[model samples]
Structures are given as C-alpha cells and as structure tokens.
Target chain A: MRETDFIGGFAKGLKVIEAFDEAKPRLTISDVSKETGLDRATARRCLLTLAELGYAAYDGKFFQLTPKILRLGHAYLSATPLPRLVQPYLDQLSDKVGQSASASVLDGTEIVYVARAAQKRVMSINLMPGSRLPAYCASMGRVLLAALPEAEARAILEASDRRANTPFTKTDPDVLMEEFARVRRQGFAVIDQELEIGLCSIALPLENARGRVVAALNIGAPAAHAAAGEMVERYLPAMREVQAALRQVLA
Target chain B: MRETDFIGGFAKGLKVIEAFDEAKPRLTISDVSKETGLDRATARRCLLTLAELGYAAYDGKFFQLTPKILRLGHAYLSATPLPRLVQPYLDQLSDKVGQSASASVLDGTEIVYVARAAQKRVMSINLMPGSRLPAYCASMGRVLLAALPEAEARAILEASDRRANTPFTKTDPDVLMEEFARVRRQGFAVIDQELEIGLCSIALPLENARGRVVAALNIGAPAAHAAAGEMVERYLPAMREVQAALRQVLA
Candidate 1:
C-alpha cells in the first residue's frame, strides 16, 4: 500500500460512516471523532456532508445514516455478477435441505455473506448479505481457510483471539490446524455446535473458472433437526450439486 | 449543498465507485477519470485507496469494485429499520397479489427501491433494492410526489427531463399536475403502461411514525394480468394493508 497512491480523506469519510452500527445507530460529532480517531472538525465536516448529500440525516443533535447510503451497496450488487449468479443455487439448496443456505467470501479475518436464502430462521442472529462471522469458528470460515495457503491460514488463525464461543468450539491452534487439514482433505467442513449451542453448519468450497476456491457455500440448521451424520447424508450431495453447477457457470 | 460543509473528495471517491455499473463493470484509470469528471491523478488516488482498503481490486489494467464494497450497504441495512420491518409485509403482499411488490424512496429525480418481493418477472428490467427508475413515470414516484408539497413536487417535475419512455407516458406538465392532484385526493396512484408497455402498477404513500410520507409502496403486474381497474380493485387494498401495518411499526 503506497501512501502516495491513497486518498486519506476519502477513506476517513467512509470510516466515519462505518462507525455507526446496530449498537450505535445515531452518533454525535464527538462520538464519531472518537470512533474514527479523527478530529472533531473532520468528523463534523463528514457528518454534515453526509447529511447534505442525503446519506445521513441529522435531527437536532445525533446524526444517523439514511437509506440513501444503501446506494453504495446497491452499486456493488448491481455491478457484480457473483451474488446474482449464486442466488438461485442458494435458494435451491435451502429449499432442498429445509434450512438456511448461504454463500460467503473470506474478508480478512472474517467471512462476509454475499448471498443467502432462508427456509426457516434457525439462528438467533439474523444473517443477511452483509452479515459477517469470525473465520476461526464458522463452518464456511474453516472451508475458506482450508482453501488458503497453509501459512496464510495459520497466520489468520494466530491473529484471531480464538475464544471458546461454545463449549464445543475448538480454540486450540493445533486442534484447528488438524481440523483445517481434515477439511482440505475431505473437500468440506462441518461445525457441530461450535459457533453457538444448537447451531450446526456444513460448508463446501466454491471454485472459480480457474478452479481456485473463491467462496464457501454452506447450509445452516438447528442441531436438533440435523446432526452431523444427517448433514453428511442429506445436505452434502445437494451442496455438491450446486457447487458443480456453479463451477460450470464460473468456467 | 453548502460548499464548506461538504467533503468534496469523499463525494468524488463515491462517484468513482458508482461509475462502475452493469454495463461497464471494469475500467482503467482514464475510464474512471472520464466517468467521474475527476482528473487522472485524483481518480488514480481514489482507485488506489479503494484497492488498498480492499473495497476494490485492480488487475493491472482494469479497476473493479470488490464484494467488500457491499459492507457499506450492509452497514446502512443493519442500522436502518425500514427495509427489514417492511420485507415480510412485502412478501405477504406479493403472495396475495401474485405480482411484484416494492417500496421506494424519492432520491433526487429518481426513486430508489428500498425493499422488494417478486412472485413473477413481468418486465425486461430486473428490479431490486438499490435499483433506480425515473420518478416522472413510475407509479411509486407519482405517489411519492403526491405526498410532497405542490411547489416542491412541481419543482422536481420541472427539473426532470420528462421524456416519453412509452407511448402512454405523460410528458405534459399540466396533464401530470392534474394526475398528481387526483393521486393526492385519491390517496394512491395507478400507472397504466406509463413506464414500460404492458407494465401496470398501483402505489400508495408510506408514512413514518411522524405522519410524514417517507416512502411509497407499490404492486406491479403485467397489463394482461392486471388492468388499471384491477390494480385499484385488487392491488390497492393489499398495498394499503401493508402500509397500515408498516405505519404501526414505524411509529
């Protein structure tokens, strides 16, 4: 990353917007300044600019992002073919397995969902296109990690806090390494009550035209509904079918 | 609108990202410069900054926005209550009407779709969240305009190019004024093949908790399947039901 090549102010402006989330839907100028580590003046200017452009709205004091900000995401979705191309397959997989199916790509230490189809709400968390989860604990995350170089996967794993999200979660680096090796050999990964109790998911890597794994496709269901054997028996074939079809289209 | 209040470089950077659409998904630095009206150096810096931040990717010659860019939209969707709150109602409306139902907000001279549910495809254009259509001709657009002050509505109408997209599109200002007046009184708007031939739609304004009209909810069907009278008789009631339900939630 060359410093001369970057526009620092533009990046700072985006950071200001990103500073707001579910927990903090509205913020003051000082709040934004503290969140983005920018001075009060810079944050105030960005907030006012966003408000003026209809991307953010201010009501007296607190500033909140407006729906107009969705245009940025819409631009990416409308222009990119991956989400649209993969949607029908996710829908089919979800319908076939009677669970929620999703596709995600590795983004740094997390996997960002790009496409999702739900048959029934299985998780407490509402998973949508922009939802993200730690790469160390999610089924899709391990599949994505397995696709990366061993050194890179280890680096990401080491960087992660690697906590026991649930009693079943494998937090030890050596154990995770063994699991990643198994996932690479088996061509898929299944997490049984790892990320959360009663939440299980099975995932397989989706390859691009060059046969390089670009994303992970997964089906998540309640553990009470589908155990590890049931997932392998019922969900695996459908996932493979979708993966094969995607490979041809991607090719 | 104030020059000092705005961060011009941030706006310019967003414009650079918006320049990539379905037609031109990839571009060189010069292409971006031409598309955004930014100088070559400015475009290069923005592109490089986006690339370094993982929001974009440059394969040497062509620069394209990456899936990571969707995070911005996700941030908005996660923080905003409108889209999520309105989705299930739109799904119910789509199921009942056996057509497509959508919610949109007026943005400048265009209406941007904020939520959508489709039962069948009726048009050549694939409508989704973030998709924009000219406000002068869309049924939802007319409904939104009808909710605004007469002076503001007329100013927007005057600012629009107001071209005839189809043979039935009303480009005359006087005729449109009469139509807007009718829509305001009737509490809804119906378009009979104004945007595209064979496409008919009925729309009603969706007011937030404050009783201010913030968006429009619409149901669209093919003319062969639903006439203007049928839209009023069938679709209008369903749209109103959704709108009423939404009002409670928004409140």
Candidate 2:
C-alpha cells in the first residue's frame, strides 16, 4: 500500500459526498469541511469536480447531489449479481408473509441492504436497497455477525460506534457475544424494539451454493400486531424455506 | 470552472468505477485502462486506492466492486427527496394497473429511473431505481422531452447516440419533433417496441406544485398482452388519478 498508489483526493471526495445525508442535503464549502474533516480548499475542489461532472449541483452558496449521482450506485447494482438474484425471493417471502423482507450483506461494522420487498412500511424510515443498519442493533446485522469468526466479529463490534437506539438495545460487547452464540446454534435471530420501538423482526443466514454465509434475510412487522417472540414461531419456517431455495441458486 | 478548482484524480477514479457493468464485472488493470481510456499506471493506482479504501476488491489479478461501493449510491438516495416521495405512488399505480410503474427524471440524453414498482418483470432486463434508458426511445423520455423547449429537445436528441433498438423505433429527428407536439397536446406518450421487442409503455409528465414538469411516470407491460394503442383506454384513467394526486405533494 504505497502512499502514492492511494489517491488521497479521490478518498476525500467520497467523504465529502457521504457528509451530505438526510439532515444536510445542501452544504456549503465550510459545512462540508466541518462534516468530513477535510480542508475547505480540498472540499471545494472535489465539489467543483462533481458539479462539472453533473453529479452535483452548485447554486452559488450550496452544493447538492443531483439524480445523476445515482449512476454511481447504478454501476454497483448492474455490475453485481447479488441484488438481482435475491430480489424475486424477497418479493415472494414478503407476499406470503404479508410483511417487509430484506437481504443484506455484512460490510465492516454495518449491514448494507442489497434487496428488499415491501408489503408495507414497517419502519418510520424507508429501508430500501442501499440502506445501512448497525450490526449490533439490527436482527439481520446480528445474524450476519454470528456467521463470522468470534474474534473477527468481536473486532467489528469494538470498531463500531456502539450506542443504544432504544432502551431494549444491547451495547455491551459481552451480551452481543452471547447473542451471537445463540444465533449460531439456532440458525436464526429475532429482535423486538432493539432497533426502534414497536418494531419486531425475524432473520436467518442466507448461505451460498458453496455453503458460505454471504448474506442475511429478514422479515419485519410492526410489534403492535406481531410480537417478536411469536415471529420466530410464525415467520422463521417460511424464511428458512427461502434460505434453502436461495442456496441452490446463489454462488 | 477554473482548472485548479477541479480534482483530476477524483474524476479519473469515478471513470474507473463506471467502466464495469453487467457485461463485464471483473477486470484487470490493463482491461480497465483500455475500457476507461486511462493509462495503465493511472488505472492501477485508481484500483489500488479503491481496494485500500474498501470500496473495491482486488482478487489477485482481477478487480471488482464490493457491496461497500453501494455507500456511494446510498448517499444519493438518502439525501434526495424525489425518490422517497414518488415511491409509494409508483407502488399504488403498479398494484392498480397490474403492471410495472416507474418515475424518472431526464438527465442530459438519458432518463434516470428514480423510483419503480414491479408487479412482474415486463422487460428482458429488470428496471429498478438507478436504471437508465436512452431518452430517444423510452415512453417517459418522450414525455419529458415534450416538456422542454423544442430547441433544447432537439439539442438533446442530436447529442444522443441514436440507433434502432427494434424495428418499430423512430430515429428521424423530424418525426420525433412532431411526436413531441402530439405528446404535448394529448398529455402523454406511448411507445410500442421502440426500446425493446415485445415491450410497450405509456407515460405522462409529473408536475410539481407550481405545475412545472419535474419528472415522468410510466406503466410498462408486455406488448404481447397489452397493445400500445389500447393501453391508453385501460391504464390512462388510473395513471391520471395518481398523477393528479402526486401534483399536490411534489415540489
């Protein structure tokens, strides 16, 4: 990893793009500098390049991403086969269960949604493809971690900025470790109000044809209607059926 | 834009990322150099930077994007409001019509899909959010082009690499200009096997609260079952209901 081989300017540009989230859609040079910890001059150069490329729009004082930026994500979705492979299965599971179902791959300390089928909005925020959730708090996240080696999973947990999203959320590393063991033994996981209040989810590991755990599958429902304890009894059987079906197809 | 204001390395990195698509997911440094028109040394450096930053995976000789690259696209979806606002309408329209519904904004000479709802796969390739289609051939593209001034629409058409995708495609700028006028009067456009064989679509312009056309919405079906001419009688009534409903909320 030579320093010259790594383009620092390209890396800084990505940070500037990620700096604009739901809270801050439009950012000035100063705001970008403050959010991404890049120098104002550096941020300005990146923003200008993005604007010139049609990825970002510049309106005098503010810079925001245009829909053209979706082409960057489009490259991933089109080039990668994971999302397309799991989409139909997710749709089928969501239809049969009358709930939202998703498939996500473990990325560092977070789980990134690759495919989803929405029967309805179970979360206040829309969880579509490309959505990210903390591995320590989400049902799919925990199930993905349970498939990893104990030491490796522990490292990811240690690296994460752990926080309790709800009163029921677990922040302690030791408790999370025990939960991982339980998930490994039972072949699935269920959560209630751990990510957000009044939300319950059941999840299972999706193994590839090679028997490697490539992703996790989850079915979510509003806890007011379907209790978390009951989802294991109700949704787990159907989820496992998809899991087995996906294994025959996934590489 | 000033020369110093733009980051050349950052622009080159993005080009490297875009070089991979459904046809070619994995590439070596030499392949990328040729595909992206970058020199071999520069291509190697960009790929190395992507691998070091965890956005790409370098499996010995070949390089490919990891799911982490989705973060780039997620940043756009999470920050943009148009996709989130139109998604539910697309779902409702798809459910009512029993066909695929989508919303897109015209970007240069292409229409970038912002949201989609699929009752089933109508096209040979699945059309989802972030998918792109040439503005000259798609139903939504024609409606959006009709919204623009005639000169502007002509300029976009000239800029496109127009070709016949199907036997029914209209490539003559003269014929397309007249079609645009009809779309403006009728308030919608219909395409029959213009983009692909056995595919038909009907589309209308999506207006903002100010009555400015912000995007285009369409319902696509198989031409085998639903003739392009008959789609007006079957789907237009329901599509107008959603289009009018969307006007109050879109900004």
Identify the leading candidate in terms of lDDT: 2
Q: Calculate candidate 2's fnat.
A: 0.77
Candidate 1 Cα RMSD after full superposition onto the native fold (Å): 3.0
Tens digits of lDDT, candidate 1, A1-251: 67788777789888998898877888999999999999998999989888877889999799998777877877777787777789888877777777889999888888988888765456766676767899999999999998888899999999987889999999888899899999999999999999999998999999987898978999998999988668988899889999999998764
lDDT of 1 at A18: 89
lDDT of 2 at B33: 99
Q: Looking at model 2 chain B, which ten-residue stretch has the lowest summed lDDT?
A: B119-128
How many Å off is the CA of A44 in candidate 1?
A: 1.5
The residue-by-residue lDDT of candidate 2 on B1-251, one tens digit each, is: 89999898999999999988888889999999999999999999999999999988998899998888888877777887888899889888888888889999988999988888877566777677778999999999999999999999999999988899989999999899999999999999999999999999999999989999999999999998799989999999999998899999897
lDDT for each residue of candidate 2 in A1-251, tens digit (9 for 90 to 100): 88989888889988888888777889999999999999989999999999999889999999999887777777887888888899889888888988889999989999998888877566877777788999988999999999999999999999988899999999899999999999999999889899999999989999999999989999999998799989988898899899999999897
Model 2 chain A TM-score equals: 0.96
lDDT of 1 by residue, B1-251 (tens): 46787888888888888888877788899999999899999999899989988899989999888877877877777777777788788877887777888989888778988777765568876676667898989999999888888899889999998999899999987788889999989999999999999999989999987898878999999999988878898877777778888888885
Best by TM-score: 2
